[model samples]
Target chain A: MKDHEAVIVGVADAPLINGKVAQPGSALQIVARCAKAALDEAGLTLGDVDGLFTAGMWGIPGVGQLPTVTLSEFLGIRPVVHDGTNIGGSAFEAHLGHAALAIEQGLCDVALIVYGSAQRSEMSRNLAGRPATLTMQFETPWGLPTPVGGYALAAMRHMHEYGTTREHLAEIAVAARAWAGLNPAATKRDPITVDDVLAAPTISKPLGLLDCCLVTDGGGAIVVTRASHAKAQGLKPIHVRGHGQAATHWTIAAMPDLARLTAAEMASERAFAMAGVTHDAIDLVEVYDSFTITTLLTLEALGFAERGGGGEFVSNGRIAPGGAFPLNTNGGGLSYAHPGMYGIFLLIEAVRQMRGEVEPERQIANVRTALVHGTGGTLSSGATCILSLD
Target chain B: MTKPHPVVDPGTAPYWAALKEKRLILKSCRACGQAHFYPREICPHCYSDDLDWIEAKGTGEIYSYTVAVRPAGQAFEADAPYTIAIVTLDEGPRMMTRIVAADADAVEIGKKVTVRFVEEDDLVLPFFALGGA
Candidate 1:
């Protein structure tokens, strides 16, 4: 299959507040702000945005229905091409491919992909408070924690089958915090150690508080256009080299293998093949880190390390500062703000790194290529994209 | 005192109904000769509507599990530090349920288990205990 060539022209992130307590704002307001900032970064206005793509309302109260249509109308632009592909956190990464293909096929010119959430400020009581549904009929009745418990199951299985220990998982958190320390925009920048991660209170077995990503209130947006169009607009173009997405199951019960993430394997392979680059050539990796275990599994699934060797791969200060492989330079979801869906932020950070927009302390010097990956829905779905400066 | 119960939908009503009789059943796809849990009308493997409810021996092995040191929600508060597991049925299907043992930590991967009916209020739910326990 011939790869569609589109370029990321602009990327912007909304101000991420700790918002530990429920804040007083809506998803629409935050998303609109992010969209405008991204457009301004690209030197484009609402009139130039012919394509608009977004995910669901993310359970924000009074956001109305249909987030894509609602956000478009709110922005005062009627996009000829629109998409609302909600595949959990990987939605925005998947949209990159969707928008790139649309742009290549002349379906739209400047595609704006946006996401925002106030999950931390809204609190769990206001959001995700629903009556018993299908999941309740099967899994939740057994007290399966929606995500933490679901991910813990996978972590337990990995430990059982691969001898992955808690310390190895803690290494990921420690490394993420180290990276976050250098990022001014990161919500949690305090230095932490593997011991701190292990000592934190356990939300689920093998998953402590430190291992989890912070529930933050934030938004992010990206603009994609044809490579030629980006050059014409005089914007720094980060070429969308390749992209792929896949899902194994919806519920944790149906996950084919708890120890392995097949979707990530499939998606990364397709992406690597499309980008025509091996793991050695990529300068940085930005992976979704919902939990420390999530980052480990993604690394293994993406072939950064051997299948069960993800634990060993992240150990010995490998992913930390000055490590050979720079993982999640912008602190990632673990240390950075994770407002519900974090896929868009992955692209934003990748673009920053490629464009040399980050601080010298945090940026990877002369970064030419970046691989951004997102996992959603209990490690059931995965999306991979390779972006390059050349 | 009451416990959490499964919400019976049109697709899963029969599975819950069979539990009342202390019998375990799952939808077996006649077309693909496969079985699945959390019953649906169509076959997940082959997408065939040609299916039938078959009695299962209720014997399986613990595929994976986690000991919830903390309750997942309010209803499970009483069961704090309980064991939840995905049991791979002998009939070739997986189901999520609790592992009832004297020590939740004793539950290990690949441990053999069999279904045991626990009654909470008017609802009967299938839980798993160590095989031969």
Candidate 2:
């Protein structure tokens, strides 16, 4: 069998509804819009897309099962290959590798991956009456604060074990906002200081409101095809140089180590090995920042910084604009839009940076390669992808 | 407002039932000698169905924790600023629980804790408090 490579030919995002408490649209509407825009960007129509990959419908209540099938029918396309890989926020990143392999094996040529969320509009009601899953049964009874509490627990442990301070976490929020200032589409653009982050009301201890991602309504899509097919279509190809995915545990309680993200270590190691590149060779990084602790842990786990040194590594304006490492140039989930699942946007931004299609002020000069990392399911799942224009 | 209660399913019914009697029990795999929390039908480590329920002394150390300054949902609104923690059991497994009968700020990692049962709407949920207290 020939070792075929898959390339990302097109990427697009639905119009971001920023700062609004609610977006007046259904999840399907947002997803369809983004899917159409992505297909148009690829200079292809729905008919050309032979595969459809999306997260499962179980994430949102009343969204029923077989979301990919529903989406395919709604878009009026009969796909030969379809998948609903539900790994939470990292599901879209997981799709990248799956679609690439499917294209490589000739199972499908064009794959469209997409995600959309109306979380902001659904937050109050969803939180009021969350369904009883295993996590809810075990942890909720004790008043565990759902998502924020779990990540905060990890943060507390990190701080206890390494003496990480709130100032260190605030630096992440401040840097992210600085990057957001350069992105006109970002939801929050106001410059903030470390003191401002610390002063923000606390949601969970050791993680204030500023440490969390913005709740907005948005969706993103990506189109992948064989490198030869992209060349035939005259599309600029962003080569998928390497990809890896792994999970450490299903729930926060089961995590082997609270202070470490072992899955991210394994995932990034496999990805870097496959791409034949080291951390220094990468031009830029796009890491998932569901919370400040997530980014800090990912950096340490991916070997970008020494364990327990992530706090120091991010200090001194190192990750902000005009810094050595241009991290989360799209403002990340912190200042950027986070519509529940944020992995797809990480890939979209990486492709944009690799193609040099972003704002001139934020674009990395002579950008040839980018690494995108995503965490899902309370940091239970991780996916890493390396992309290069070469 | 009504507080959140456990939705005891068949696999975990035994564990919750035992808790109702003020007993803390965890599943131990006979094949691998590993104990796990949030009762499951099969062992997570060895995937063996041969399991036994062992009474735990309920003494443990605080592995990690956070104080919720804001309520996660309406059910927890009255309990804002509560301390939620993962306690590493003496039996070699960890469980998601809360620390009560103490100030939230005073809850520290590595502090010894013991399981305490709290009655909530006819359900007895296990929580951890300072061991010596």
**For model 1, what is the alpha-carbon lDDT of residue A308?**
99
Q: Which parts of model 1 have CA positions greater than 4 angstroms off?
A: A1-5, A19-24, A57-65, A125-131, B1-5
True-contact fraction per candidate equals 0.63, 0.75
Candidate 1 displacement at residue A139 in angstroms: 0.8
> Model 1, A307-370: lDDT tens per residue?
9999999998899989977899888899988887789999999999889989999889988999
Q: Top TM-score: which candidate number?
A: 2
User: A254 in model 2: Cα distance from truth in Å?
Assistant: 0.9
Residue pairs in steric clash, candidate 2? Answer: none
Q: Candidate 2: DockQ? A: 0.68
Considering the two chains of model 2, state its CAPRI-style docking category.
medium
**Clash total of candidate 2:** 0
Candidate 1 residue pairs that clash: A22-A121, A23-A121
- If scored against the real structure, what TM-score would every candidate get? 0.95, 0.96
Best by DockQ: 2
